[model samples]
Target: MSQTDSYDDTYTESQVIMTTVKIIAPFTLTYGMFMSLHGADTPGGSFQGGAIIGVTVLMLAFAFGIEPTRQWLKNSFVVGLVTGGVTIFIATGLATMALGGSFLEYDAFSETFGIAHYWGMEAIEVGGVALIVAGVVITLFFATAAGFTPERNRREDEPLEGVSDDD
Candidate 1:
């Protein structure tokens, strides 16, 4: 069976890459979480936090190896990335329409959920952030991995008829 690696393994064996990735991942994860949990109370929120998590994933892939990272990349992941954002956006819009207000009226959610408008808006904003982070991070990791692999390289010089370059 082929073993998959973690995103942090991009720099796996190298001492510098390993050390930096190790240190950065924890810090970024913590910071991201902090931002996410207190999104309503601060400048940073779930989106920023999600991006932080995404960054950690990217660093892990760099520190560890790509083979390990494949496990995290799933069909659901692609769907989730797009769906999460769209879900939040659509929900917000629908809420506004139902409430007879603008497209993203926070008043609708606030009233529906029995929360303050500020809170509703914050939730919507944060959710949007989450989707953005997921999509970006996943896409970036795949791109990075491709950059290092031979198969990822679309060499125009290679002959289509199985002819050798030296021929």
Candidate 2:
């Protein structure tokens, strides 16, 4: 095949990869959200959810191809980490201040929100869980991607080079 033909063939391969990623991303994101949302009331919570979501992106890259996976990871991974964490922290702080209490203390916010102090604490706990989860996911994902060794690159790029004929 000409160089152009080889390049064109990559498009087809990438399309297949993207199709698989599309199938998987929504389930992963939704599961993560569910875990975060019900963290206070359930067995599973933010840390598990965040890790699950981050792994899905990693899996997509692994199964489909790196380019599409990298795009997805690069696009929203940092945003998710920062926005989720900052939002939770700010909201908790503001709620505490509004309730005339110390930072992240929910007792005052309970009065402000007209909910029980217990419920307020629950909300804070959930937010904390989510922030922790997201932060870890972002940290791990970036670390893994950044430290991708030359061996990994060769394995992914060549696909067949590492295999032995004895197999």
Candidate 3:
């Protein structure tokens, strides 16, 4: 294919929209980070931060195409992100357990390790959340658009014994 054909093939966005998202995306991402960071100190927290980050990736997917995005975001990365996030969150609780404390006792971690409670909470917020949000969001966004066949199959999709197609 020629250069013109290549341009046609790409899932290119309009200039105006592209520029607008470009301008807005950074702030959106920053806000997401802020959500995670501020969760312990303020109203926001891990889950919300994760969702925002996920939405940011979804927006990028909207801006580009699934295939191209998939090219950059491999399965390993997605799995790693999710698994790593879970590990971070769980490990915090586990560490406390190991230290003979209750689950997710940030104060325990602080007292044991001579670290601040806020820092531990931030770890839970940023590490646990950011990865989980990014992984799940990106995975779901791509999976939903992957065009896979339903699990029900032809037999399951067929009408019930008493039901008619017309009915």
Ten contiguous residues with the weakest lDDT in model 3: 1-10
Q: Which candidate leads the pack in lDDT?
A: 3
Give residue 124's lDDT in candidate 2 (0 to 100): 55
* lDDT scores of the candidates, listed in order: 0.71, 0.67, 0.78
Compose the digit string of candidate 2's lDDT tens values, residues 3-101: 235223242356766787788789888888788777667898766776776677676656665566566666465666656776776787787887789
Question: Candidate 3's error at 128, in angstroms?
Answer: 1.1
Q: Per-residue lDDT for 3-50 in model 3, tens only?
A: 235233457667776677788889988888888777777786767887
Q: How many angstroms is residue 7 displaced in model 2 relative to the true structure, after the best TM-score fit?
A: 22
Better of 2 and 3 by TM-score: 3
User: What TM-score fits each model?
Assistant: 0.68, 0.61, 0.74
- Whole-model lDDT for model 3 versus the true structure? 0.78
- Model 1, 58-119: lDDT tens per residue? 77776677656666666477568768877887887777888877887878766667777786
In angstroms, how far off is 56's CA in candidate 1?
0.4
Instruction: Quote the lDDT for 43 in model 1.
Output: 87
What would you estimate as the lDDT of candidate 2? Answer: 0.67
Judge candidate 1 against the unseen true structure and give its global Cα lDDT, from 0 to 1.
Answer: 0.71
